[model samples]
Each structure stands twice: as C-alpha cells, then as structure tokens.
Target: MKGIVQLNIVQFSLIYLLLLIILYIMKRSKINQTKLLIVASLRMTVQLVLAGLILTYIFKNPHPIFVIIYLIAMIAFSIRRVLSKNKGINRNFKIALSFSLAISGLFVLSYFVMAVVQVNIFNPQYTIPLAGMIIGNAMTGVTLGMKTFMESIKTQRNKIEALLNLGVTPKKILLPYVNNALETALLPTMNNMLGMGIISLPGMMTGQILSGTLPTTAIMYQIAIMIAICTSVCLTVFSSLHFGYMTLYNKRNQIML
Candidate 1:
C-alpha cells in the first residue's frame, strides 16, 4: 500500500501517547527519568531529520571520502560518550579506546564489506549505514566493557591482590572479571540478535522492504548486518579488556584499582 499522510498522523499520535504515558508512570514511580524522556524525544526528532537529509545526499554522491569522514566522526563521538559516562578512568584509556576499537572495528567492518557483501563502488550507500551500525555496536561494547572492567577492579581490589600475592599471574587474576565484563558488554547485541525476527523486525531490513525490495534481499541484508554487529561488538569488547587491563595495572603488576 502506498503511504497516506493522515495515517501517519494517527500512527505518530499513538506512538507519542504511549511514550508520554510511560514517562508519566516513570515519574510517578520516582524513577528520576524526566530528563530521559525529554532528551529522547528531542534526539529522536533531530537525528531522524538530519539522517534523512544526509542519506539523500549520500545516495546521490556515494563517495569514499564521505564515508570515511562520517565513520571518523562517529568513532570520535562514540569515544567521547564512553569517556564522559565513565569519568575518573585512567588517562591511558584514551589510547586503549582508540587503538583497540580502531583496529578491531575496522578489521571486521572492512572484511565484511569487501570480502563478504561486495557492493559495487563500495559506496556510502552500502558502507556508511553498515559502518555506522558496526561502529555503533562496537561503541556500546567498548563502553560497557571498560566501565564494567574498571568498576570491577575497584570493587574487587582485595580479591585480586590476594590472588596476585599468592603467585597468580596478572592475566589469571583478572581473567574472571574480564570474562564477566565481556559477557555483560555483549548481552545487548546478543539479545537483539536472539529477538531479531521474533520480537521485532530490524529497522534496516524493514526499511528495505518498505522501499520495495524483495523479502529475500531484505533478509540477506539483515543477516549480513547482524553478523557484522556481532563481530564488531565481540572484537571491541575483547580488545578493550586487554588494553584496559594494561592501562589499569602498574609496572610492578599491581592493579591501580
């Protein structure tokens, strides 16, 4: 069915109504979430509108430079967000965040596009959106892993030192918490993958179908995108753990935590 303007008004109304009701319930429950609702609404509008315009340009241009600039901006923004939320972390985390994420994320993303998907021109049409998806997933995993790793070290400093004092290597001593942090970091991406077709159709696949692609084509894109997300997130979290641990521990092998 072709789109209808009046139908969109009704759909938007229902969506906003549900959202506002949830916000009100959260406020009544003393959840301190007033700002979240406001910011979320504002962000949804600004991001979608900007994305719409940019995508139009990208679809026309499809330049590699545009793709690079976009991905770089995304990586920088994601790094800032991670650092902002987890303040008081070691300074070296800046280095860890850059190298670990850049190396692993770019590795997986490049291979996925060139080796697997094999789109013509390797254009922003294909690269930018998938790059955004992969980088965004990696950002979440990196932030969660670093945050969890740092906090775990702080909270379990006693246990860690005890193990180390008993002759356990730094790697072995930190392995448990590192594993836990990686698992926690991957949970959201994993959960989305598990719920992909059952609970909700992913935005990319749904959008493709809405724009008149065949079901088979849409499904292929969705599966490929999902695997890319999984790979980037896993690589990011794993690499960040090793990098983060090195930054936290001192030359004497004592944890700074």
Candidate 2:
C-alpha cells in the first residue's frame, strides 16, 4: 500500500472554510452561537497543532519514561475534564474516580497492547495512539456514568429514603441507579460497535488504512481497540460508581444529599 498524501498548510487552511459554512448556517438559523463556534474551531486547531508537535517528539524519543509520562498526563487531564463538569464532588470521591480510571484504563491498555497487539510495552507508535483511544473512550464513559449516577441519587432521594426505611441495604438501593448509569455510559459504544464498518469507518481504522496498512489489518486493530475500549469503560464505570456512591453516604449510612 502507498503512504497517504500529506496535507500541506494551504490545504489545511482551506478546511476552515467548512467552519465558515457552519457559522453561516448558524447565523441564518438565528442560533446566536457563531462566536462560540469560531472559538471552538480556533481551540481545536491550536490544540491539535500543539499535540502534533508534542507527539512527534515523543514518537521519535520512544522511551519508557515518556510513555509513562504521557499515560499519567492523559489520566490527569481526563480526571480534570470529568470533574469540571461535576462541580463540588467530594475529595474522597474525586480520588476514587481517578483511581478507578487509572487502574482500569491502564489494565485494559496493557492487556490489549501486550496480549493482543504483541508490541513492546512502551512502543510509542502503538502505545500512545492506542492509549489515547482507550483513555478517551473511558473518560467519556466515566463522565456519563458518574453524572447520571449522582443526579439520579439526588433526584430520587425520596425513593431512596423510603427504601432505606424498609431495611433495604444501601448497596441494593443503589443497584438500580448503577444499572441505569452503566447503560447510559455504554450505550454509545454499543451503538458504534453495531454500526462499525457498515455505517461508518472508525477514526482509528481509517487512519491505519490511510497510513498504508491493509484494510484487513486495520479492521483487526479496530476490533481489538473496540474490545479494549468496552472493557475499560465497563470497569471504570462500575468501579467509580461503586466507590462514588459510598462517598454519598454519611457515617450513619444515610444518604448525604
């Protein structure tokens, strides 16, 4: 397979016109979000350009320390992003959430890279991109699961209290909310799996193919990535919710909020 053609600066700059079309449509619709759209577009470009430079250096270096640093940075940034949306989370819960994400995400990432891909543990080319995919999906999953679980507990406080009065264990009372949160968190992944290859070419698979990999090989990697993503998401969501719900309780085992 031939290597993909690289996009030059002129070609890249042309892509911004697409954003202009979007802004024009938003204006026509009176959405009042043109400025927000422009800002988001600028942020995306700046972030991606910086990421590309950093990744280039990291890829060339290919050191275990660099890999570890990148992984930690990804986890830290993901935690911050998740918590930013969920204000006033307790310190203990925040710690638990970070722990769950790091442990579950790294475990799945390691297993996929070593057991499935059979690459060097710190191979930058494979590890960094794969880690990004796994951690990125897991972050989204944790965010949805945590937010839904917390909100449900608050909104259904009266029902939870009733169940508590009936001698229902706190764990049992939380089972329904936990179940709902997991479903909400995993639904997007499930839908993607269902539609993959048919409805859309996934980003990873497309990138691989464009980079001169065989379609069959790219498909294999995509399948492995999807499995790793689902496993990491499930583990993170379950662990985070389990530990998080405990924090929502007082010393007397009553609901905190």
Candidate 3:
C-alpha cells in the first residue's frame, strides 16, 4: 500500500475557500456570525499549527517529562474551559470538577496506554493524541452534565423547596436531576457510537486508513478508542455530579445553592 499523500501549501490553502460558502449563507440568512466564524477559523488554524510543531518536537525528543507536562497542561486547560463555562459554582463544586476531570481522565488514560495499547505511557505519539481525545471528550461531557444539572435545579427551585418542607432528603430530591444530566451527557457519545462505520467514518480511523494502516487494524483501534472515550466521559461526569451535588446542601440539610 502507498503511504499517505501530503497536501502542498497551495492545495491546503484552497480548502479555506470553503469558508466562503458559510459566509454567504450567513449573509443570506441575515445572521451576524461572519466575524465570529472568521475568528474561529483563524484561531483553529493557528492553534493546530502550533500544536503540530510542538508535537513534532516532543515526538523527536521522546521523554517521560514531556509527556507528563503535556498531559498536565491538557487537563488544566480542560478544567479551566469547563469552569469558565460554568460561572458562580461554589468552592467544593470547583474542587469536585477539577478532581473528577483529572482523576477520571488520567485513570482511563493510564489504563488505555498501559493495558490496552501496551505501549510506554511516555510515548508522546500515542499518549498525547489519545490523551487529547480522551480528555477533550471528558471535558465536553462534564460541561454538558453540569449545565443540565444546574439549569434543572434552577428551574425546579420551587419544587425542591416544597419537597424539602415535606421532609424529603436532598439526595432524593436531586438524584433525578443528576440522573437526567448524566443521560443527557452520554447521549451524544452513545448516538455517535450507534452510527459508527455506517452513517460516518470517525476521524481517527479515517486518518489511520489514509496513512496505509490495514482497514481491520484501524477498525479495531477505532472501536477501542471509542469505548475508552465513553468510559472516561461516564466516569468523569459521574464523579463530578455525585460529589458536586453534596456541596449544594450543608450539614443542617439546608440547600445552599
């Protein structure tokens, strides 16, 4: 099989022309997202290019310290992004969010690298890319779960107060919201899994196939990664919600948030 073909600079630049279609649609729809789209596109391009350069250097150097530092940076950025989206959380909730993302993400990552892939966890090529995918998905999951849970609590504030007056435990009152949030968080990943290899080709498998990997091998890897991603998402969201909801009440069983 032939190796993957690299696109020249001109060929790659041509792809930017596709953005014109989105711009035209926004104009016709009278939407004001043109500036936002342009900014997002530019940011994505610059970030990916910078990441590519950094990864190249790390791959060549191949040190345990590089991998550890990279993973730390990724987790920190992910936690910050999640928290930034969720303003006004209490200190305990913030701690829960941080620990949940870091612990669940690292646990799944370590297991995937050491047990499933059977590679040195310090191998930047495998660990870094896989860590990005795993942690990114976990971040998204936690964000969605937290958003849904918080919104539900806000909207049902009266119902919660009524329940509390009726002697209902906070756990009984909040458990449903937690469950709903978790299900909402898992839906996207579960739906994507349902349609894999049929409705669409996922990025990792497609990239591997293009790089001349055996189709069967790529399929196995894709399946394994998807399972890992789902597990990471579940564990992170579960830990965050379970630990976080406790903070909403005090020792007197009074609702705080």
Index of the highest-lDDT prediction: 3
Global lDDT for candidate 3?
A: 0.95
What candidate 3 gets wrong by more than 4 Å, as runs, is: none
Candidate 3 lDDT, tens digit per residue, 150-229? 99999999999999999999989999999999999999999999999999999999999999999999999999999999
Worst 10 residues of 1 by lDDT: 1-10
* Better by TM-score, candidate 2 or 1: 2
Model 1 lDDT at residue 240 = 75
**Over the stretch 1-257, how does candidate 1's per-residue lDDT look in tens digits?**
44323446567667777777888798789999789888989899889879879889877877777787877887788778877877787778667777777777778778877888776435777777777888888988888887787788788878987888898778788888889999998898888888988899899988887877887998998998888888888888887777777676676877665
After superposition, the stretches of candidate 2 with alpha carbons farther than 4 Å from their true spots are none
Question: Which prediction has more favorable TM-score, 2 or 3?
Answer: 3
As a whole number from 0 to 100, the lDDT of residue 141 in candidate 1 is: 87
Query: What lDDT tens digits, residue by residue, belong to model 2 across residues 1-257?
Result: 99999999899789878887887889899999888888898898899889889889988877899888988999899988988977768888888899999999999999988998899989988888888999999999999998888888888978999999998778788888988999999998988899999989999899889999999999998999998999999999999988887887776767665
Give TM per candidate. Answer: 0.83, 0.94, 0.96
lDDT of 1: 0.80
Q: Which portions of model 1 miss their true places by more than 4 Å? A: 1-39, 120-122
